[model samples]
Target: MFDKNHPHLFGRLITFIFAFWLIIGIALFSLNDTPAEINQAKAQTINNVGAYFWAGNVKDLGGGFIKTGETLLEGLGSSIIRISMSPRFRIDYNLGGGCISNFSLETLAKGPDLNPILTNPSFSTIIITAYDGTSFSDCETKNYLYPDLYTPEITAAIEQEYKALAQYLGTIKGKTFIILNWEGDNDIYCGTAYGATANSCPNYQKHIEGFTKWINARTKGIKSAGVGNVYSGVEFNIVRYLKNAGLPSILYDVIPNVAADYFSYSSYESINELYSGDNGTKLLSDITTAKSAISAGGGNNSNFIIGEYGFETLGREDSKNKLETVTNLLHSRGVRYAIVWNLLDSGGGFGLYDSNAVLTPSGKYVCSLYQGSACFIIQSPSSTPTPAITQTPKPTTTTVPTNNPCAPTSGFASSCIEDGTKIITVAPPNISNSNLNLTISIDIPANKNSVIWPTGYYWSATLKNWAPFTLQGNNYPGSSWLVNSASTTLSVPYSNLQPGINYIVTWDYIWDGSKWLGPPCSTLTNSLCWRLETFIRP
Candidate 1:
């Protein structure tokens, strides 16, 4: 209530005003720093699904098939799922339903023990048939002892085996990957042991056809997933090696045709000899080629999985060293998945943990790389028609790049932008966030039209959404967030802004949401990088 003319009153008023401004200034500075968004080009590309990583192969313990299902998703995040539907066929004999049998793992290796994995929630994605003969294949080699495959005894057995696999998998109530595979049937040392010459080899097409038919019967038809079952039977390439073993044309010639049916291959080398470990050479190099060659030979529906591929350190001290190199190679070559091939030493020296139950150094080594984008199936648009012939991507975990969280080894590496984050920037020469607010710029890409800045991300536990504050746009569109229009710039109010904590990407462009969507790059017209994520801090 002081007089208006008082000198002291004026001073007090000025001081009060300054103090208020100072408080606000401090709060504004402390609002927290948000990371700069990554500048990206206009996105118009569409993709199908998330890429899968791999870890696979295990021997059965007293755990049975259901236990194996729990173990598959539990032990290896993206590794091979245990397949146990094949039955001893005898023409017209249908297996499964009431049929039950037992099996055990003879080849034990070091790795994450499935005891805990079996309890994981993701186990729902696993299909468990009664575990049976997954041991190293035993081929009959007895000369002049070949039986006609079309006969009921054999045909029925094969069909029953397929039916069992299909029936068990058909019961899956979650996101499961079916493994329609067979191993003991492949040409192995047992073929020679039984004295069956190559010329007298039994019919290979019948067995594979039966398997495919069973899968189709279960899945409704030859779908992309069913056709892509090459990885399940990856270890049976024993056929390829048979030619060098002096087998007959009937045996060798059938390889390229049916080898991919189960994603076939076989390897008994220790990790040490596998990689040589000389300079930087890996042991799995040759093995990678064998698998790739087979996958390419098979048709589109051919799946590429390595159901069995591992070595024992007991034989070679360097066995563990070759693991990384081989894993890296497989990932790089687009062999979508693989299993470590072990359980109780039920069969070999490959168990990640000791029979006594402890993680081996090699077991730990393979597990470390099992996570993340090991094999990214990158699509390269060919000049072909509707369904583009995209090459399968290879391993993308080697040599991680700086500042990127979704590390890319090769193929299409991941973006640094998190999901649901908004962008804020201007247009013209400043189409990129690099030049903001001012109008001085040039060289705008054709993809970009109307450049609108993003309001950025703010957190509110109550909202639970990324940015939980009021929004308002001037030239942009998003104001209260709820108000969204593609054509306008968006302005979102933030409760706070922290730098490097949010996985945000800020790219500049000129797009009116409705029509123009680009910062046109000649090399990226039809291509798109829709989203990305990074390791930022909160």
Candidate 2:
């Protein structure tokens, strides 16, 4: 009787232990599968989505009145309300010269007689991108001796206009982001004084400098005016032309010098680079580079925003996919705000909706992305192949000479790899003075059909992130170049390097024909592409 009871008790004990272990295993699996980071990112993104209106439903229809009910802005808000059942849309109120000065705050507050898009309860924030009539010609001059000739009145007028806009927007109902000048860089091209010798024109340079100063003053004035909930800054255009001309850093500095609230830029490259699948990476690099330049210029403002981005509906059937890809990439990178170019499909073709206020495929995709819906489907294009434009070419593979002074101590091996399976190495790892010219080399697996566009970045201790290196002589070595080999060398002036601090240099991303792929790790992954070397200046 004792032996039989012992056997039964032992079996019961085993069964209890098995059940306990099973429950514990299930709990562990659930914990591991919890998408904590993803959920957090989504929550953050919901707050960052905003809109930009060019020629859209937001424009004043016929009869000298804006039809609020039939407008694109109203349509967008309504759609969002229907989908989310919440009134939390962020509207980027884009105003050209006329709208900025002519629109009355009281009238705007009330909205159009019929629809009233601006004052709709759905809006949680209002970002104003105001552009005055001051063109590039107004800012740049032909004679260096008269650098101030073309800009004083124009600058003053702009300041006054901005003051008025700020004062009015201050009384608005929600958060406000004010940009005094939208795409001010275009003024450079409009200056007749520069003629063919644009860069050589001292007047042009002086005007740019003066304009930057004026922007700073305007920003201060807006803040001093006691404008409630208004964050003011200036916006510039970020394109390969400006970057190749070595203008990104110079322009970025204008924001912080004047103590502007944030830095902003607009890029259409995503639309152009969509076929190559490098749009997202290119944009990421551009933003990182801009941040780096801003920090190096002693400007503390790090908040970056995309003022405008859009693609045409004509000829390109894959525009929707491209928009989704770019939007997702921006969200993933933690961009504060990104405004799509226009609300209506005007003749320029970047509009998200038609004149009738119907949502296009691209518009729908953008709305879905903004609304946190998993409905976006990546569709293939039904047009001619877009030519691959390589910004940085791969270098010819050659043996690293033992006598080279800039060679890394660890030698060039496949380590500290980032996106595109690329490797980076910095030479003369130890820095003693500010005059050293640091050499950077990058290597990628050789692919015959792939072209390379390499963007260089350095870590900024002050800003606590990596910034784009200000390349010397305005040489854009990263522009599209055919890659014959897998390695390339980049030179950096040591004087430009931040002294008494460690700097890690690496590539922002690589274009591999199909898409732009960044380093496997990003700011979110607890790792950034690769750490080539930590140059500590003694």
Name the runs in model 1 displaced over 4 angstroms: 1-76, 83-146, 152-157, 176-235, 245-252, 255-262, 269-298, 314-317, 370-538
Indicate the TM-score of model 1.
0.39
What is the per-residue lDDT of model 2 for residues 1-538, given as tens digits with 9 covering 90 to 100? Answer: 0000111223334334434644676411134432243334445544455556433343333232233222344435422211000011112222223223243323333344312444455555556544333322222232212236336675565456556656655665654545545555654444221112445544455556666666664675577668776676666664355556554323554554667776666665333443332335567666677667666655543466766666653233345544555666666666667777666654455556654444567767666554321122122211211111111111122333334323332212123333334355555544444345556554545542222233445554445444454222111111222232223333444555455544444433345544544334322343323324454443
lDDT at residue 386 of model 1 (Cα atoms): 14
Q: What is the lDDT of residue 350 in candidate 1?
A: 57
Off by over 4 Å in 2: 1-47, 56-65, 68-70, 78-118, 132-161, 191-203, 246-253, 269-271, 277-279, 298-302, 313-317, 370-538
Q: For this target, which candidate reaches the highest TM-score against the unseen true structure?
A: 2
Instruction: Supply candidate 2's per-residue lDDT for 327.
Output: 62
Largest lDDT belongs to which candidate?
2
Error of 2 at 482 (Å): 57
- Give the Å error, residue 321, model 1: 1.6
| Cα displacement (Å) at residue 56, model 1 | 15
